[model samples]
Target chain A: MSSPSRQPLLEVRNLRVEFFGRRGRLLALDDVSFHIDPGEVLGVVGESGAGKSLTGASIIGLLEPPGRISGGEILLEGKRIDNLPYEELRRIRGRQIGAIFQDPLTSLNPLYRVGEQIVETIRTHLPMSEQQARKRGIELLQEVGIPSAAERFDHYPHQFSGGMRQRVVIALALCAEPKLIIADEPTTALDVSIQAQIITLLKRLCRDHGTAVMLVTHDMGVIAETADRVAVMYAGRIAEIGPVQDVVKRARHPYTHGLMGAIPEMGADIDKLTQIEGAMPRLNSIPPGCAFNPRCPSAFDRCREEKPYLLPVERSQVACWLYDETGARREAAHG
Target chain B: MIAFILRRLAQAVLVMLTVAFIAFAMFNFVGDPINNMVGQDTSLQDREALRQSLGLNDPLVLRFGRFVANAAQGEFGVSFRLAEPVSRLILNALPATMELAIVAALLAVIFGVMLGVYTGLYPNRWLSRFFLTISLIGVSLPTFLIGILLILVFAVLLGLLPSFGRGEVVRIGWWSTGFLTWSGIKALILPSITLGLFQMTLIMRLVRSEMLEVMRTDYIKFARARGLTNRAINFGHALKNTLVPVITITGLQLGAIIAFAIITETVFQWPGMGLLFIQSVQFADIPVMAAYLILVAVIFVVINLIVDLLYFAVDPRLRIDGGRSGH
Candidate 1:
């Protein structure tokens, strides 16, 4: 758990992202903020268009064209990193932070061998010879649970199966010993059996290296299994963020509660799980008040009128009208 | 991998034989070699004697068989008017055209790739518009027009270059190169630039589209996130991946450049295989004409082989099939 006495490894404050698209400007991310402590995994769970991947990309400085970080500060170890020059930023990227993309095939360059790709990344951040980098690359592959890592060093990405390719990608991300890694849906493309293996490897690596990870996925199962703390997002905004156990087991926001309720438990015999009312609003047509208010069953008079700010409620931070002073006092009076 | 190459080699041989038979048949369809060899005043016996010695009197199939046999031994018989071996004649004129095509292709690749990569990385409306306009002009204009326009500007109007003939030939070993002389280089510029422009535009478009596509791939985003420098990401990663398609396009374009060099050669009046081909065609020099077609077919086959090899080198997926798993 992140304490007040220790500075968090990475902090994103009031992060706002926009896209000047063909249909006019759409706010992709609105005041999204979170923090990942050292050696902690922060799972960002949301729907397909919930901006979970976008947040990871924004943090990793890989937001593609049309989408740009409009406002906010990304701080790494208390140093402002959002506005660094390209060269300086690039240095920070390979040295300080690494990225694992959703699709392993897309992450690995087909022309080069997997070992070569890992070696290139290692050499880019660290001052080492080719042989040294290669040795480290093999070590990384082995650490990532790749079978026969030494012999597989010269094998191309296409030569490896989908699961093996993802393992190679993991090795590539860890080559530089980065302080933080942004893994966006790292196991989505793998087999059901392989997914667990990959998740275990990622967890073990993070623990071994004491690396902070921003694990973005729509799979709440993966989130519960891997993340220390979790951030639930809806319509590009963080609906709730707290310890994984707290957010998953004892959800604060309406969206988070609905999300946790939807997950099917093994022994429970309930046929129809609790379902939310409506879908998360489109980025272009996000409701003015709370983004999830349309689907929230507890929406009140103030929930329709004004956007609820993220406020402290115990250890978790939630952005919903129900948790506010007026809503709480009203609930007390009603009871 | 060895099996792949062996299979391609066998296919090349089959293609060469097919092209040779087609060339032989096409040549026979043209005017008689006897008419081109002997003057109008020559007697019937003399014509018969000349046809007999040249094996022209034989049946078309027998002559084709004989021609095939001779060609197999690197002999394409003698030219009708020139009275020189067709192989020697083609060999003599090959260098200038080759030099021209090589220069043009190289320039096309360098300029095209650089410009395409630049625009691909930093796509803007104005730059794309500029590329579109250039592509329109380059794609719309035929080779001859581009050649003539270049000549009219640099040769006729400016008087800076020689319009006709391959400058002085400097024989080096078995090969005679035109680019060894200063005037040869000067003569080469207009034609190479003229020939290269169309291909350059083709290459530029290919590289641009491939680069644009590759830049959006997951690897590129991952590379950027890894904090690789722009140079490393664009040139090292993006450009390298884009080259798989570009290489194939360039290889095919190289064959096209050689084929189109005939028109380019005639327009420039350059003494190359293309010039020999036109002159041989006009005079009904069957051997030279047949040899030229066979030569071109061989060039294409060789290029195909090279491209296949390169494909294997660049892409590992191509080798995944017919292989066992694991290292």
Candidate 2:
């Protein structure tokens, strides 16, 4: 138990995802690797199509067909989950790893009562009688801050407001007491005023349950407030990963730096927030050397020629040639 | 809830009155019923007397009012050709048509849903493709043609069943059923299939599309993530969601089966109201024709009402009151 505790709760190594389309095969995710420690929040921040949600989906083994994992290993508590049979994976899904999705308005089934959905989830992964499951389900609803949970349990999802529905969804995800929860843009569909409340509630519940969370979102403010560690993704690859504060304050990768700059500082009177010059590359048209090189502001000859992998830069692991010590010396020689 | 039902009831009543008026107007002009009623040898004076006694000379409005009043009282006057009360004639023919329609509808819905789920779930499998191809054929082929082919196969080539008529019916009170007798049950098989084939395919396609759409919803994905088994996810969640639309189509199709069982009944010579309706049309029996139309319209209106009510049961989103009572 101690040895396992020392190991990360979830490890994704060299994950590659591909989509087979009529035109040809397109690589969606390439050499993506990351891990989450027990009871830690790993915020995955990226623009849309950066594979932030895809990564979470791949972890949960729910990638829609025509898109599949071409290579990689996903392990939870040192057991390989990527290759498990569907039934085996299903058993592990809610028992060991659960998932919450975007759009709480559409997450819980509208046909069933709120409590029934949660109770069904609990019973599926755990050995409990219907009555016991219902009891546990009500308790979960209360834990997520639903008022009059026992009475509200029998109500349909539509009866609840957007924020309340999200609370229900969170409760459902946490009901099985899974070690990890893959929350893909969980708060992206909520009201702005309700966003912080949901985030705080999620943080509190996961902490209370000791459940590690892979919070995939594009909101930097959300990451700044909730995530313990942050991985900034660019073109389906992790551009930089470090302690949330370090990455936010002193971003090493140019892409990460541009993202941080894009977020407007509250009190600073600036003409405009910094904008990244070009869009992320299309999957089929990504440049050979580095995906971000064409759009990169500080692109050099080396950056345009050879791709960079994550290298230790102070506290963060940044994938940029500028942080490469040997490459810097070689650049000096060329200069 | 009561107000919603009451509103639908009022709408149903209005629709029925319109249908009744239309049927009365249309059949009233399908040539003179008096000419068909009287023989060539009958005297002109007797014919005039017959017309006067039948009140054909009454004003159109008064006649229409009388027709509606009699129809409302379940008295559709008398059939000119059979010289029998039209309502009684319909009552005698009704059991056979109803039994055939009910059997056919059950067959369509049960197998349609099963095949639909199978095709929706494993759309790429050869069996599913075969089912889809079969459904395409079912949808395209005319009902009479399908009935003839079924007869050729089962009755001619195999000699396993009778070719025509509702054989060996056992009367239980007034509702005679073919189910109790082996010959009656066997006789029913071909016509029921012929009647149900088109509706089965229609329902299959509808369910398949709905199932595919529902399977892609966030709730279904969430159900999968919640680690529900494929069976539970597919049937318990996806199938239930598909049922709202499925119910609407199924209800309408069931009504269609009853109304359009004419071709099937004609093919089999089945002693049903559709066959009676066809004979009445050929003989210019206006009262029977008008009654048949009104009856079919009533069936459609009642089915629509039932379907509207079923929506509240299947989908909670439409239930404005919410589940405050934990029902």
Candidate 3:
């Protein structure tokens, strides 16, 4: 493993995911790249079909059958993990890296008690007696703010409420003290009030344990509230990557700007909330030059003809042909 | 749970009563048992006297009541065919049939569950296809045909096993070696295998389908996501969930096995209840027929009751109190 100080905890370089759909092989993740530092939360925000969840699943090595990583180097502390055998990958998964899924109900095994599930996960990677594991399981449950943890240990998953079940799921994920945790829309399945509580609990727990998190959700509000940095995905590529405040306050890429505008502001006088003008292009029908060029407001001749690479901008990165030299000159003259 | 048990017990009683009433009505409406008992050469006066002596001259309702009372106390009058107490006749043959059915059911469940789990875990693979082919053949081949084939190959051709009978019914200190003898059990193998073949196939297919369906549940995926080995995921989690339905079908099949045992007994001539039933039916022994019908009804009811109770044990969610608590 690379030293914590010198290397990012998890890094993806030139990652490309494809699926063998009925039409043909379709690219799902086009050269997606990002790095997550230790003890940081990188929130990925995009509408459905933007490949946000796929990115998270790919990183955790849990993509379902038929969808696969085509070309990529997913480095866990500078060691490539994309090509690892399933058994070896499984060892790294749930132990070195934890995952919290969207649905709390389905995430747990209904047959087992919540505490037993936690102990099973803990004992899988750690050497501990049943009694010791049980003790630790109770402690983790209490840490996640489940009341009467010892008493609740014997109750099955269905006995718990939705918010409580999500807590149990989080406890299961944290049982092995993994370095990186991938939470894919963890709060979406929850009620509005419970959603805030869980988000707060997760942020606090991750901070206390120094665990890096990849929080994936379509809710920009959640990203603004909980994420340290935000990666804005459009179609299959990262259109913008920067600190949450900067990205939310001043987005550079046109797609990112449209996404920010689409967020319903509090106390707005508008009759209806703004929506993005066009639908996400079909995976097979992705445009030639830029995947988002058709939806982008600042599409130029070059934007239609040549794809834009993610290039460094002020304190972040933006992929837009309008940021090129000629386009910049036009903007400067207008300013 | 107690309420559920009580409800099931009430249903069992109703079913048994219905079966007894049908048996009684059918037996009385068919013909006189006395006429069958007395030969054609007997005088009309002698026949009348015999009918009066056997209480066949009594009212049909009264005779039916008497028969039911006697059956409840384990008496079934005298079998016209066997010429002995129907209870003793049943007792003599019951063990052999019970032994055969028990062993066959046990073997079917064990082998069927093994094959089913294997096939379900690796579906569309060679092992699955092989088991599927064997199951198809088992289902198509009739039990008597299988029995004859086995006897031809193993007994006549190889001379390895006894072809028929419970092998001399050896006396051993108060315990008769009816089924304990090697030759007696060896004779049982072919018939039991034939009797169990279709049941085994049915059970295997049910278990395989249930297991495959359960394996696709999210909990199984969750188990896999926990990094559990394939064996642990397949057996510990998936198989346990599949067992409730498998067990239910097994209980139902067991009842069918009892009914099918009559045909199997005649084919093998194993001197079990089925053969007794056949002989009684041929002679028109009404009391014996009623007794056997009641016994079969009791067995079916008891098995179903046990299965109902087992459902609660297997899935805690099925407990009546558990359901009520949800509301």
DockQ of each: 0.56, 0.57, 0.35
Go through the candidates in order and give each one's C-alpha lDDT: 0.85, 0.91, 0.83
- Local lDDT at B33 for model 1: 63
Highest-lDDT candidate: 2
Cα lDDT of model 1 by residue, B194-266, tens digit: 8888888888888888888998888887778777778888888988888778989899999988877888888
C-alpha lDDT of residue B22 in model 2? 90
Real contacts recovered, all predictions: 0.64, 0.70, 0.24
Give the interface RMSD of each candidate. 2.6, 4.1, 3.5
Candidate 2 chain A, poorest ten consecutive residues by summed lDDT = A1-10
Candidate 1 residue A117 Cα shift, in angstroms, is 1.1
Across all candidates, the chain A TM-score values are: 0.95, 0.97, 0.94
Q: Residue B151 of model 3: what lDDT?
A: 86
Q: Which DockQ-derived CAPRI band holds candidate 2?
A: medium
The DockQ score of candidate 2 comes to: 0.57
Off by over 4 Å in 2: A1-5, A328-335, B39-52, B323-327
Q: What is the DockQ of the complex in model 3? A: 0.35
TM-score of each: 0.93, 0.96, 0.90
